[model samples]
Target: MTTPASHLMTSLRSGNATAPRLTWYGPDSERVELSGRVLDNWVAKTSNLLQDELDAAPGMRLKLDLPAHWKSMVWALAAWQVGLETVLDGADADFLVTAATDPVEGRYDAVIAVALPALAMRWPGTLPAGWVDYAAEVRSHGDVFMAHAEPDPAACAIRAGGGGVHSQAGLLEGFALPHEDGARIHLAAGDGLEGALAGALGAWQRDGSVVLTAPEVELTDHLLATERIHGN
Candidate 1:
């Protein structure tokens, strides 16, 4: 039915397939690049885990309480693919996903902890009861995900920052994306999740990629020129 995920999948397959879909730079000068297919693979595995194992379906609410890292972005797309609402807080959620060690403060149906480091393969410490390690469990799921029902784009997709809601269709509607010139977007302020989301969606819509920097990574002219980055 041409949901955002279906449309994005089509673009991923038919567009400039060789270009990088996302690139992440860490505070320690670590770099990671993901092609469209590779990004789709992550999304698929995440979707399978949320849908098949967790029994998450349409109308479910999931709290994305993690940082604005690559995995968090992947989980957002995965939740949208399975028609789950991605909320910023744990209020009225079926699941709360975070990178923090202590999530006992929140009451949720379940908790999933993600280890955010690039090389860290698993959660560092012991997880609380009923909590799942996203990295450890997600890899065991199939690489391809098939949704049981098509997502309604008009349905509420994200709830962020003190009661703001955005639908899947609205997220893309009137989105003015730059040309698909393989531009590398440099984000300066990493505070707003909604803004980051809009930028990512715009980049993907135009077959461009994003260069995300954490708060600690300083943006410099030399770094930008060396990276051949277009703009922020």
Candidate 2:
């Protein structure tokens, strides 16, 4: 059975796979771009890591403690692909994905520390014992994802900060922001992770793309013209 997550991935990889799907601008003039195929590959690897290494399965809650960066977006997509409920808030979760330098342990079953830099092959600093270094381990996982079991459409996909929930089937339709078809939308990091995710989903669903900028990055006229951004 094809779940919503799987279907979305399929759509993402269908046409113009080499076209830029997500572009990110961060502090210090950092720029990163991911094509549709590349984004799918990252999601696939992360999903495999979650399933094979972390033993994640449908109904398990995975909390995201990272910022609204491109890597954070990939992690969310991977969790959804593996049928894990992504918790944006709340304390009780089986797995915690964070970029924090010193993440508090003993709260979640597993803590995965992520490196925010686009080209980071491993964590920059020493990770606490027992914590998983995402950059170090994720590359060793398979580039393709195969679900151990199909996800239920009625299963919760996102747990919002306000304690609201969106089902897997309803996630895109209910939360995605409005956008014109094939438009290149600019997403501001100040909108937060949830808003960014929603906007990205909306754009992808409409065969559009997103240019996401970090909070510290300014949206200048030059940048907009260079990226060919249609709207924000």
RMSD of each: 2.3, 1.3
The pairs that clash in candidate 1 are none
lDDT of 2 by residue, 49-159 (tens): 999999999889999998899999999999988888998875689999999866484577789999998888999988888899999999999988999988888899997
What's the C-alpha lDDT at position 91 in model 2?
Answer: 61
Please provide, for model 1 over 198-219, each residue's C-alpha lDDT reduced to its tens digit, 9 standing for 90 to 100: 6787778766778777788888
The local distance difference test score of each candidate is 0.76, 0.89
How does candidate 2 score on lDDT? 0.89
Segments in model 2 whose C-alpha atoms lie over 4 Å from true places:
103-106
